[model samples]
Every structure is written in C-alpha cells, then in structure tokens.
Target: MIWIIIEFLFPALLIALPLTLYKSNRPLMTKFYLRMTASGSARKLYARCMLILILLYHYVYAGGHFGEWGILASTTFCAILFSFRRADRWLTRLHEERKIFFLTAVLVLTTCAVPHLHTVAVTLAFLLLAAMFYPSRNVLSKWTDEENRIRWMNNPKIVSEYYY
Candidate 1:
C-alpha cells in the first residue's frame, strides 16, 4: 500500500502541481514537449523512474509467471498510449496501434503456453516500457484565465490550495 502511494508520487505531482499552482505552460511546453519527445523525451527522468519501478516490481517483486506480473507491467504503456492519444482517442487509435496491448496480453497468457515464464515475463516487461510515454498536461490549463490567473480562486488571492 505504501509502495503504491510512493510510486505514484511523480504521476500525482505532474497532475497536482499545475492544478494547485494554476500554472499553464501550454503554449511554450507544447513546443517544448515536441522538441523533447523528438530529442528522446520519452526516455526522460520521470519515464525512467516509471520504467525502473516496473522492472523492480517484476524482477525483485513478482519474479515469476507473466499473468501476475505483465498486467501491472503493461500499465506504463497503457498510460503512455492513454495520454498521448487522449483516452477518447481509444476508438480511433486502439484498433490500429493496440498491438502493444495485445503483446502484453500474449506475454501474460504465455504462462500456460511457455516454460520458465519468469524470463519471458521480464523480457516482455522491458519491451512494454519501450513503446512510448506522453504526459498529459492541462489538468489545470483550463482553469487559467487571460491574466494567467486561476479564475476559480476569486479575489486573486493565494490560498491554501497553493501548498496542496
């Protein structure tokens, strides 16, 4: 339980920071992410953290059959694909690009299909991480106004939400 929460810190902070601080780097960072992604942002600091965490879970934690491990392993790709193409993009893109999902499913299914499932499971876990990652922005962008203010916080006051 504690590990789950601890592992969630980066993802949570990525969402919470802007929402609480009401900062919108949409314009600049849109270009920045493109540049970064082009320059290999998919393998950046946070992405590495998530990958390492997944590897830790599989090698140090699950260390066994694919079923118990692959589902959790694939979530990184699920999240990347989910964010890159909005979850709404599922119908449009999933059928075409969902090979990653199927690959995860297959590796997980191979528990009964293969021997020494742990090695295959770990291999698939790392392969799953290689697909891609895209962080969702604008969890707070919609709340920012023309003056770059958090319109919801009337009086232009800095409230306790800042520390949140």
Candidate 2:
C-alpha cells in the first residue's frame, strides 16, 4: 500500500540516513558530548536541557511525524534548534544561500500530521534530500571572501577528491 511507503517506511529510512551517515562517528559524537559536558558551563547545560525537551516532544507524540500535532510541535523544536545553530556568524552563510529549500522542507514537515501519502512523500523526500545534503554542507563558507569563493569555484569539479 502507498500508505506503507508514506507511513513507517519513509520514517524508517529517515532514521536510517543518520544511522548510516553517522555510523562511523557515533562513538566520537558521544565522546564529544561527554567532553563538552564536563565543563559544566551554563550555556552548555541549557542546551542539554533543550535537547531533553526535544526528546520529550518526540516521546509525547509516540514519535509519529505523520500526525498533525506532532508535525507542528516537532517543526517548532527543529526550527528553534536550527536557528540557534545557523544564526552563528560561522553558520550563517552556510545556510543563507539555500535557505528557501531548507525552510520549505521545514514547512512541509510541519504540516504533515495527516496521512496523505502524496503529501507525506513530498515531506519525506524533502527530509531525505536534506539529510543527504547536510553532511556535505560547507561549514567554512562564512569565512571565505569573494575572491576565495571565485577561486574555489574555478577549480574543475572532483567528487571523489572532495569526499572522504
């Protein structure tokens, strides 16, 4: 059933994207989290609290992104989190260029609380594309000057050379 595609399967694949992409580095992520926590700074503690709230929202909905209420709540949480990260001078330009697509995806996910297969697929597809797009996102883009941007653009494309 197309319902199956838009229901559990799409979300399952969404879960899988981070699983696969972060597979090699989950231990490192844990380690980094631990290391950051040890400092016990107020900001860090607040961030941890927000992370917990995000989890609470996830749990409260039985982790259902397809339900309307869940989508609104989850998208709110995500937008808050993304704003905090992407507002940094270091994170700004990296997101500003493609902001339309990113915001569109967020809007799609936010409205997807009902089980319309076509709509859900579009939402899921946006998420899938975003998941794949993010890991390769240029973190250093904000630090570059126009000359650097041009110089970097001038080089012939090399996919294999670019990715580890």
Candidate 3:
C-alpha cells in the first residue's frame, strides 16, 4: 500500500514542481533553460515525458488496484486544474472560506486518526492547502524589491479586487 502511494507521489512531484517553479520564477528559470545545451533540454524533456507516460501507464494498465488508481488520477487531475484558480476571494468570501477550512481541518484530523489511509489523506490535505494558498501567492512577488529571487505569501484581497 505504501509503495503504491510512493509510486504515485514520485511522478506527481516530478510533474508538479517544475511547472510550479517555472511559473513562480519565470525569468530566472527561462534564462537557466536557455543556457542549457540542446542535448540537455532533450534529455530533460524526454525524462519528464517518460515519467508521466510511465505513471499513466500504471494507472491505466496495472491490474489488482484499478479502482484506487482511477481515484488517484482523477483527484490529481482535478487538484492540478483547480490550483490555477485565484484564491484572492477568500477574504470577502468568508462563508466559502469557512467551508473550505472546515473540510481541510477534517482531512487533517482524519489523517491523524487513520494510519492505514495516511498517504491518501495527506495528499488531499496538500491539494486543499494549494487551493487555499494559490491566489495570494503572487502578492509578495509584486512587493519584493530584491533581485534574483521572488517571494510568495498570502494576503487576502478586497471584495471588488477578488477573482470571480
């Protein structure tokens, strides 16, 4: 069971982190990528493609755990899609925030209570946390005066400024 979780998680991290990092620090990452040789880019791209292909292969083709794999893929896809939304409305949308917070709290508590399903619970908690934090992340990026680095932090927005 643990190995199953690890197999899913490792591929997810590979796919998610690079994309997030490139979004968060585009100029620097772009420059870095540009400096790499063509062969290097090919190798890196191939590796990432292969990782995703292999993981999806397991999800679609592997036997004996089809239901769990399907659930994992669906939830992961939804989480990734939802992560693109701006969470700035969390301030004025107090009712919505309350519901989200309550659900996240429940997941966290459930993770503590159920050792057998720890990995699934933890993954869900992380997805919820990302949804909560994504919109406010770029707030600090605009505020920072420093060069060569970008800061990210959560600072809620006004009602009119909120993302609808």
Supply candidate 1's per-residue lDDT for 88: 26
lDDT, model 1: 0.40
Model 1, 70-116: lDDT tens digits are 44534555355334324324322322366855867576567526543
Decoy 1 TM-score against native? 0.29
Poorly placed runs, candidate 1 (over 4 Å): 1-42, 62-96, 112-115, 122-164
lDDT by residue for model 2 over 47-161, one digit each (tens)?
4444454444344333344455445544454465444343232222332446754665566666554453333334434333443323223423321456544443453222212
Q: Rate the local accuracy (lDDT) of all candidates.
A: 0.40, 0.40, 0.40
lDDT of each residue in 1-164, candidate 3, tens digit only: 75566566744654576457534335554433222211334424433443354445344334435444444553454344332122223322322466866876686577647644443554444444333323232332333334312311122222113221
Worst lDDT run of 10 residues, candidate 2, spans: 155-164
In angstroms, the error of model 3 at 126 is 2.4
| Model 3 weakest 10-residue run by lDDT | 151-160
| Superior by TM-score: candidate 1 or candidate 3 | 3
